[model samples]
Target: MRLDLPCLGVFFLSVIPVNASIRERLSYQGLFGCVHSGLLDHTGCHHFLRTDSGMEKTKSLIARIQFGKFFAILQSYANKDHFNYVQFSNQAVKMNQDFLEIKRLVESIPEHDDLASELSFPSHMFQLMAHSATFLKDTSNDKSRGHLSVYHLIDLSVRILALHNVRGVLDSTNSISEEKIISLHRELRELVSTFVHDGDSESIMNWMFQDLAIQAEQDLQKLWQQVSVHGIACLSKTDQQKCIQLP
Candidate 1:
């Protein structure tokens, strides 16, 4: 592609073959380092990653960047506005399922108990919330509690880890907005906050857990009144009730 570097516009290069992948010319290093950082603009690094990387490559890069930015947003800022209750609750369920699987795989090791305990919350969140909430209700689909395919399990594991990094920020920062942090846990159905209480009390965790019921009420809004929202209430309703349970 022959074009002006100083005046970089969205215009395409006529010299390059129309079918060529843009990754042929674009470099992640140049994009990451030389591109003026976007922190000054609320858009941040999103625009820097945009390019004509052909249809497939562009789609792949967009997905990766979306998840990357999503993680970064959660890590750097607790955003209650982006929280989806159904999605978060389902993830909580899936996380439980994943913990069980991980335990099964590590059963022989002596430290497995410790690791399994450490993993429980993350795993429950994985099983219930990781599948697209829109796609999860079908009950017959591959991702439903009944089916729980391997792909679903693997994908949930990855997302829980990404979200874990996001929540891990709570352990380090003093400036995270209390309302925002509380909103996140509430949106996740107040399940994550359980782990926050198990050890030395973190000021941040305590703050996040406080006012949780109020946050959940606000976060759940009208859905709280709906009678049909029964299947996933109060975390572990399935396991405790002896309903259709995942092994």
Candidate 2:
């Protein structure tokens, strides 16, 4: 029943195209059909397709979530300061709100639309918020380990924000250029390097960092192969090696 993180990561990467296809196939009628068969009703379908306002609301919410004061709190916590429980909790609540809004917006879109590619499930962000909430409750009496958990939470939040920003850019343009992909890889590398440290060796945090870096590298490689003019010509030899380097 327990799934390995690395395997789950690979599974996620492998399913991107399939998930995109499935999302593209979604339609109001299809949703209504699901309702008609006792799955959902007219009211539920309407809620699902709140498309007109949902998309704009989702974008606004995401922008606020990504560029808000929440990240400042995360930065403080990441720097080994005492964990601000109130601030962290407030931000987690905001993240949950963003997640729900995104889910609703994605549901509202018609099937086979290019806009669907712009929205991802925000699975990592959801998991990060859930875990942070649980850690807050469970470690109320253990401030020492709580700091470590907070560090992990901060890293997760940064990763989520980076992904959201990248997806927003890709979605707006509806196409990925070689330069854009290269920029994405560079941004990912910089983000990963920001928190990864030698002192984290043998810790769960270290493992998580490694897993994220490896998965990112693999994803970039796959994406490069998918869209590169000559399947790696876009990258210099040094960059190519960097793309495959593990944490």
- lDDT at residue 81 of model 2 (Cα atoms): 52
Task: Score candidate 1 by TM-score against the native.
Answer: 0.24
TM-score of 2: 0.46
Residues 158-229 of candidate 2 have per-residue lDDT tens digits of 554444444333333233433555556666656555446537575545544555555555555555555443
Model 2 per-residue lDDT at 133: 56
lDDT score for residue 84 of model 1: 43
Alpha carbon deviation, residue 237, candidate 1 (Å)? 23
Q: Over 4 Å off in model 2, which ranges?
A: 1-80, 85-90, 111-114, 136-149, 152-156, 170-187, 190-202, 207-247
Question: CA lDDT, every prediction?
Answer: 0.34, 0.47
TM-score of every model?
0.24, 0.46
Angstrom error at residue 179, model 2: 8.4
